[model samples]
Target: MKAIVHVGLKPGVLDPQGKAVADTLGRMGYDEVHSARIGKVIELDLEGVAKDKADARVKEMCEKLLANTVIESYRYELVD
Candidate 1:
């Protein structure tokens, strides 16, 4: 099975990296670039797990280590 995890900062959290990129874009004449947010993607391959079990395990992984629940949110998808 293939799993994809998307991790992003929660709303109201400060994103300095994102802000810096936005500032640079404006400096480069990309004034149209209003706001930007930085996030990450994690892909995993697993074996011996059924689809339902995989979903539950992946969610646990995100909660325990994949994301900082205080400032970040994460969601994952399981694929064949």
Candidate 2:
């Protein structure tokens, strides 16, 4: 099985990196962009696990290492 995790800061959190990207885009003439948020995508492959078990394991991985729970939240999905 494969798991894809996306980790990002919650809304209302300040994202300096995202802001910088937006600013650069604006300078480059991407005026349609009002705001931008940055996040991470992690893909992992594991064996011998059911869907529910895989979901739990992936969630644990996010909580333990993939995301900083203090400022970031995460969501994950399973793929074959």
- Name the candidate that leads on lDDT: 1
Cα lDDT tens digits for candidate 1, 1-80: 99999999999999999999999999999999998999999999999999999999999999999999999999889989
Clash counts per candidate, in order, are 0, 0
Off by over 4 Å in 1: none
**Residue 44's lDDT in candidate 1:** 95
Cα lDDT, model 2, residue 65: 93
The RMSD of every model to the true structure, in order and in angstroms, is 0.8, 1.2
After superposition, the stretches of candidate 2 with alpha carbons farther than 4 Å from their true spots are none
Give lDDT: candidate 2, residue 79: 93
lDDT of 2: 0.92
Q: State candidate 2's TM-score.
A: 0.89
